[model samples]
Target: MAIIKAVNSKSSIGTAINYVSKKEKTEEKLISGIDCNPITAIDEMKATKELYDKKDGRQYSHFIQSFNPKDTLSPEKAHKIGKEFIRNNDKFKGHEILLTTHKDKKHIHNHFIINSVNYETGRKFHTTKYEYQAMKDKSNELSKDHGLTVPEKTKEKGKITSFNQNKYRVMERHFKGTARSYVIDTALAVKKAQGKSTSREDFIKEMKDQGYSTNWTDTRKHVTFINNETGKRVRLANLEKTFNDSNFTKGGLTDEFEQTLGRRERSRGTKSIDSRNKGVKRAYEELHQGTDGQGLNQPPSSLKRDSGDRRGKQKGTRANDFDIGRAKEHIRKSASENARSLGELSKPDARTRKIEQEKARELERANRRELERRIERNKSRNRENTR
Candidate 1:
């Protein structure tokens, strides 16, 4: 929902920068009753002005606004997003970008004023119509990332086109695909309107009236039909070309062709989340059973647990003092038995004892031999040190 309007200024880059900043601050104060943090200031302007001296620091002005996505016109959000937009676009690097909020409307809308000169190159930064549209797309993207409510596609303005209901129906019925309908209708309409044989000028006028456009091909050999709103174009065959080449018709109706013929509708149109919520609740009821018009007839299971009487009765199966003492005594006796098993009282019987003693003796002998080897090594080290 964000809108972009660029202004070409005939002022110094320093003057333009200061003017834009002041305008932004004034608008922000009027709308939000607060001063903006004022991102991208005059010093940045001086740095930029230094780069493209021949461009005279400012030959053009760019006004950029990033509108609030949730409402498309929130003043606070507009101010915030607009600043971010300039901060990101490299074209605004050396130029002054003034971001402002407009408060005179029900929805928040903001504006950006930018100087067109590039500090590195004296050339102007060129922004096309598509780039402006892209700015709106980017605004929506930032809104979604911030967890703000995004307006459904249905609420957006569809691309503009000339074809209306009657024309669309005529094209749909007569043409095998979209192509035949548009080409045939256009041809037949031109033929029927001939003032006994209309002149080319008259034919072009009639086509324009019918919401068709005319543009010449590069060689000026072929005529093209266009949709004014979307700027989509389609090439039409001259009478001679149509008759001379059979394959010319084989191109069929492409998406581009249909669009030029105004056969396209915006796909973004979708119900907003708030509007869909109520319908979802109603749909849920018809699919589920055991419900009164008001609510469930029986109390839910959770309510039964909170009734109190059952819980009180369940708590009565408690252990007595005698039972507790006996349990402790049982645990102590088991621990005592485990201790004896690991000590003198639980030593193995004769044959098993003899095997363990033999194993221990062999281990001791191995240890003593290793100790004697260590002592011999130490004696050899002492003799070397004495020498």
Candidate 2:
């Protein structure tokens, strides 16, 4: 399997590029063997580095690479897969790209170095927030072509294999009560809503309304939570505590309250598997579809996933490229008028300019509000599952 790593380090870009180019296979071998000809590896690196380091005079640098070891994968196969990936992602055409493989890891993986500059405009590339996930998803899709084992969507807890359990244990210890808090709060909210005896069915509905989520870990057999607020891994025991907390139990709430509580419960933990499962079968059904939660499916519906599916506006009314262009033009015109006119004569024009400025300001304010709303919504939705 190939693992993709994209870095925005000014100092590391060159080191990373060179390390992949010369450290593993000779620079010539990479260029000749890889199908990305006319788009040579060295030239690709140089072009990408130049644009990322020079354009807009912004010192911010970024290079993305995909790593797959050579022991498990032949350079020939890796090169083909890399070329295919680039061909499929045509929108990334203008950017410089290099495909390389290393001999260091267990599974052979390839590295893709890309300059984060938009070739058409000689401007910095606006990397999307979901770019990494998109890359992983694409990589997974490509793996099928090579007859490689395509990783299935796994719960965050399930992903903690023996190799990485210690790392997770450390995180779980440090972020104590983080993920579990949400689950506990949701359970408590459900209980309080029904006068200390909420039905499991009602609790599940409340959780769904609020967009909370729950998942089973086939490896661990734990009902893990993706806390919406903390984005931490929450085990089931923590949920029990948050529910018993005084603040949630004392108040009477509607289905909305249960929904909100449910959302909080599921959002505490974050795992890539969660995103992968967005379009898959429901978590509850996956676990309880056949047998009760006792078998492979451990935790049943008192812990329903609040799917977090409801949608709202994203990217608040912030100015677009066109709006910014107009504002710049207005400012230039206003500046010229001030330079040419007498102080008194300029008063009317200045007032008119001021009105234009206010319009721009209003648009900007609306833009900010819209962006903020989207950000909050994204944060909330992100917490809906444990990868």
Candidate 3:
């Protein structure tokens, strides 16, 4: 089986080009370079992109296409298949590429460093979900043509093992028996805890008590446990399917916790709104009493000073002091309106509604500033008239 994976190159294109085309891995440049010197080819590719003003942050698409270690294909044959795969694919056409095969590992894998910008069209390559599928299909086709063994396809899609899995596998294969033992022991302990604990918090606490540290949070998708002594972080989901966070929900542990958490959050939110509404009501009443003893039924405009007393008040109370009081009244009204509006939003949609609430507050602030400016102008005009 051949697996292909693409990585976006953020570092220097020349550096990646050199690393893949190194003499030690590529048999002293004999097994490297497609049409020209690999380094020169990449430099020219970059220059071509710059000439067309298509140079982007992503300089290249680095791909690793590896065959099964058990496969008996030669390095030269594997390199040819990789080159053909890139040439035949419509997604990689008209692009400068460097191909190299490494013999350092048990499996024969090809590394491809292709320019992002197409030399002919000056357009960058677009990646999609189907790209990996296309690569695998092409690889399988080429393997069949070369009389190589092709793994049978199953009705159920197999899980793709992650790089971390392979890394740990190598460590386990070598002499790191203690680390491997720690991982297995921790996974078994967590599984046992999952069966007993009714809530996620309880399970995590139990795991910590048993000498494992959990970094699982409500925001995280997966739970990770670190071995306290070894400091090795292992993803619970990666260890076994039954130990995954999704399984906890299926087994009724996380579901119960989530429902309980939701109710508590809603209760807290309701109490917060009630407290805020009371504060707003008290502030509104104070503003009404302070502003010339006006009633609550009167509009904000009615709080303006009389033309005769404006000059006297302007001397006694600074324009800023009057504006501050008016601003406070506006804030209280805005808060009350926002609180009522939020109360109508569904609990599930409260986060989205908060953005709208912020926009409304900004609009209210703009109106308040304009009203304050008008009040200040009126006071200035009254003072000049009195002069």
Per-residue error (Å), model 2, residue 228: 20
Off by over 4 Å in 2: 23-27, 32-72, 155-387
lDDT of 1: 0.47
lDDT of each: 0.47, 0.47, 0.65
Question: What is the TM-score (0 to 1) of candidate 2?
Answer: 0.37
Clashes of each: 9, 38, 0
Pull out the clashing pairs in model 3.
none
**Candidate 2 residues 1-387, lDDT tens each?**
554444434454456566666644534444322222322334443444443345333333333334334325666677677777767875566554556655455554456656555544556644442564576668768877776654333233312111123433543543464544343344433344344224335544554454545444346544444545556455454432322122221122233345455665667545546765773656534433322223233344522322232254433331111344445787999998887776754688788988899999898677656644543443344344212
| True-vs-predicted CA distance for residue 284, candidate 2, Å | 60
* lDDT of each residue in 63-172, candidate 1, tens digit only: 54433334534456566666666666654564444455666545555655554544335467655446645655666676666554443321212221111334435444
Reference-based TM-score of each model: 0.33, 0.37, 0.43
Residue by residue across 1-387, what tens digits does model 3's lDDT show?
676665544678888877887767767533544433453566566665654566766787788888887778788888878878877888877676778888777898899888777766778875643565677678778878877765443221222222234444543443334544555566566656665565777888888888899887878877788979779888765664322122333223454455556777899999999999999997766554533454455454644643557656444432223445677878999999999887777575786778889999898677656644543454355345435
Q: Candidate 3: lDDT over CA atoms? A: 0.65
Q: Where is the poorest 10-residue window by lDDT in model 3?
A: 154-163
Using lDDT as the yardstick, the better of models 1 and 3 is 3
Better of 1 and 3 by TM-score: 3
